[model samples]
Target: MRHTWRWFGPVDKVSVREAAQAGAQGIVSSLHHVPTGTAWTTEEVEKRQQEVRAGGLEWELVESIPVSESIKTMSGDWKAHIAAWQQSLRVLAKAGISTVCYNFMPVLDWTRTDLRWETPIGARAMRFDLIDFVAFDLHMLQRPNARAEFSAAVIEQADARFRAMSDEKKAALSRNIGAGLPGSSDGYSIGELTEALGRYAAIDAGRLRKNLIHFLSEVVPVAEELGMRLCAHGDDPPWPLLGLPRILSTEADYLEVLRGVDSMANGVTFCTGSLGVRPDNDLPAMLRRLAPKIHFFHLRNVRREEERMPCSFFEAEHLEGNTDMVAVIAAIVAEEKRRKAEGRSDHQIFMRPDHGQEILEDITRGAQPGYPAIGRLKGLAELRGIERTLSHASYGLA
Candidate 1:
């Protein structure tokens, strides 16, 4: 497996050189300056790709060409936006930057209710508490159907938290949820966020998933023709987005989308941490089955709520999560072996430590989605150890 680092364009605090030194062979990034609904020109992609080559690393993937909200909800002029996306794909193909990772999570790319929740180690990590989410949805946004979405037990817990909270604390909670957290398109206020959520309210999981398939059907071939892969990462918890259907939460979703598009380009960034959060998920079995379409891999661990109320989340060590890391790595090793036996050069999967917890000296600062130095460094080290240890076991020849 070839590891890549997600760099946030030129302004990223972490340099491409740093990424190279960290042992990443490829850079997973995007044209952050390019707005949604606009085509990313080949000139821009080549310019960024050049930077990677000069840094002694390859530019293998564009982590995203952020799909517009217009395209997601089919609001207005979506065809124009989709056409632009297609054209951009063609442009990227011409430039030879093929592998791309994108998400379909509406409004927020990913949500965390608290960015500064104190960890037991006295470090700050992003926390997604159920009560905090309810506090934002019911008390702050005051949606008409908010109460219906919560259970009696959840309502009781949320009510107690809401009552105990000062106005400033409540407002902060609302801002945390309403503001769309970080790594999303942009910050959203209460009104803006509620309206955004409302746009997807009419869309159920089936329709949303259908839309996602529709998108892949259009763009996947262009990628495949150019020998590129489009990897879709599953949005975490509650499965699908609040408004849109989540087709990718289950193995069937992956199969359906792959069949819908019928292109080699259509694949998945199998994220163990996100998929592992669900108890029913069997990562190794899924990997073995979907190995051909597994374009990218995300390795991380989550500590599930042991006995907590409402939402008891777990943030475990990279090797210490609910999902068996050793087994997952073994499956990956098996995939590599199978692909090699089949004479496929595209078997080198990309892996990254998805989201790690904040720890050590990073306690004082804000890091994007657990991208702190200590956390990621620790994760990379741990994952490297696992990969090396398992490298020998899975492929006996190694």
Candidate 2:
């Protein structure tokens, strides 16, 4: 595993120098100033790369050059958006950034009801409470047929939760879920969001997936030609939410995507925390099975509340979540070994410690919601220790 960190450009609270100091081998970043669907110029890509190199690190992966919503729904100048997306890929490749991470989650990128859910250790972490989300969907957003989506028990609980909250708390919940996070596409206002969800009213998981495959069919060839790997990030929580269909949430989803495009350039950005939300995901086993198509990794463990669909979850210490950290690391290390045996140059997958808990100095530093400086440094340290141990053990007797 190649140690990597996601840096949100020069304006980020966590500087590139700090990232290098934290022992990151490379930087995962993006040109956030550019609007979605606009083609990134080669000059812009190189300028960012220069910044990364100046801090003594290479820009190995573009965390994302976002996919346009038009492309997702196949509406509103989608062909033009697809052409621009392809051009962006060409530009990125020319700038020597090989791996690109993106997602197809409609409307919001990732939803968290609480940005600072208090941890038992007095640290703060991002969390998604199922009841809170249901409250927003049924009582707050008031989506059509929202009551039908959840069981009566869940709806009743959500109603109580919704009725108990003050107006301020309700608005906070709305913003937390609808407002964009760092490196995501954009936020939606309540009115704007309702309209957006309305567009997807007829689009189910199957149709949305078909749209994704159609996208891959067009872009994967360009990626292949440019020697770039396009990594589709899995949906956070790995389930549908707010009536929007979620397709990229399971191993089966990935298999469909991989086989649909049938190109080496078509790959997945194996995000353990996102997929780990589902008890059925089997992280280590999935890692072993889909190792070849894993172009990048967002390595973080999530502690699932009830071990079922729509369960609450929060970011845990890198080694302390429900995921078997040691086993997952072993599978990754083993995959690298197999790739090396086959003489593949890109055997070492780029992985970054994702969504670290806010603790220590990070609590007051007010870093990006989940990308706290000290918190992620601590995570990287723990993950590095694990990687070193696993790598050493693979060598047989020392």
Candidate 3:
């Protein structure tokens, strides 16, 4: 794929121009200031595209459209919200921005409990350690099913872990998970988290999937008309646990959603990091099977630990993760070649080093993920070497 860096627009510590200078040809971004369920106008889309283009970079992917709560809950004004979403897609299409990336992770977008995860290189990376997450959910937030979310054995494990953690450690984990993404719908206090889980207590996995399909069925045709394509990311570990509903958890789940809408406009964002957390994902094979369906890619790595409950534990480290980065990149290259052979006009897929550490120079100051110069430069360097070497040497011994 084409090299794209994640840009959070002008307000981002890392600007679009900076990304251009970072050897990036494209910028994967969103109108983060736009609240969920709001209609983004053609003017708004054009302005953002112009800004990116002015920075000497192409606006390659809209990282998300931010699915609304009503749309997710299938409640009041949902149809109107879906229509607004369709309108936003048309607006982008009119502006000639064809690629859009979105995720269906409920409430929070890619939740993590620790922003200062450790790496062997003496650099601290952001991670979603399961024990840290569980401690926050059960003890800090005190969500009703939080305790039950952890398996019985794991609950005991978590109790010991929580007891062992100092007041400072628990405080950090709570802040980390709740600091919230820049433009998240609502910031959760511990109280809100409890209430939110209870609200979702009624919407099971099946209902959530149905809502997703219904939302897709409604707007995918609009995507087709605009010649716009969406890269819908799957919900990690889709099982209904602790009353949290999951729509796109498995390969079958993905297939069901895809088959429901059945549109070229409807596609998936294949984040190797998210899927790689599960050993069963089989990254290389997933590429072969889902090649035709993936519209964008998030290439990163994660190590899986099966012992953790709710989510089998995973840690993000570009090279060390369970997802075979080498094979995954090779499959990506092959897919691009296949697309080219099939006469596809879509440009190379957009990718970013999903999340990076608050490292060396950055640790003393800054948010956890947004602008990590050292870690991401290292990650991009590694991936660049991987891509170039693989392009030269078929599949092995490169």
- Order candidates by lDDT, high to low: 2, 1, 3
* Preferred candidate (TM-score higher): 2 or 3: 2
Best by lDDT: 2
lDDT by residue (1-398, candidate 2, tens digit) is 88999998887788899998988888999998898889999888889999888998989898787887889999998999999999999888877888899999988788899999999889999999999999998877888788887989888999999989999989889889987647554788888899988888778999989999999999999998888898999998789988888998989999998999998899989998999889998999999999998988899989998877989999998988999988888888888988998999898888999989998888988777899998899999999888888788556411
Q: Can you write out model 3's per-residue Cα lDDT over 101-210, one digit (the tens) per residue?
A: 88776666566666566667766765666666666666776666466556686677777788899999977776666554544435666666666566676887788889
Cα deviation in Å at residue 394, candidate 1?
A: 8.7
* Count of backbone clashes, every candidate in sequence: 5, 0, 1
Compute the lDDT for candidate 3: 0.73
Candidates arranged by TM-score, highest first: 2, 1, 3
The TM-scores, one per candidate, come to 0.92, 0.97, 0.91
Q: Of 2 and 3, which scores higher on lDDT?
A: 2
Task: State the weakest 10-residue window (summed lDDT) of model 3.
Answer: 307-316
Collision pairs in model 1: 205-245, 303-314, 303-315, 304-314, 305-312
Give lDDT per model, in order: 0.75, 0.88, 0.73
lDDT of 1 by residue, 1-398 (tens): 88877777666655778777766777887887777889988789889888777778877877788888887777797888889988888888888777788877777765667756777667666667777677666777777777876689888988888878888887777666655323444677877877887888788867777888777777876777778889888876535433335556667777887788877788898989777777777889988898898989988887676433235464667887688998998888879878888898886788876667778766655556566656766778778777787777555724
Q: Which wins on lDDT, candidate 1 or candidate 3?
A: 1
Residue ranges of candidate 2 with Cα displaced over 4 Å: 393-398
Our tally of clashes for model 3 stands at 1
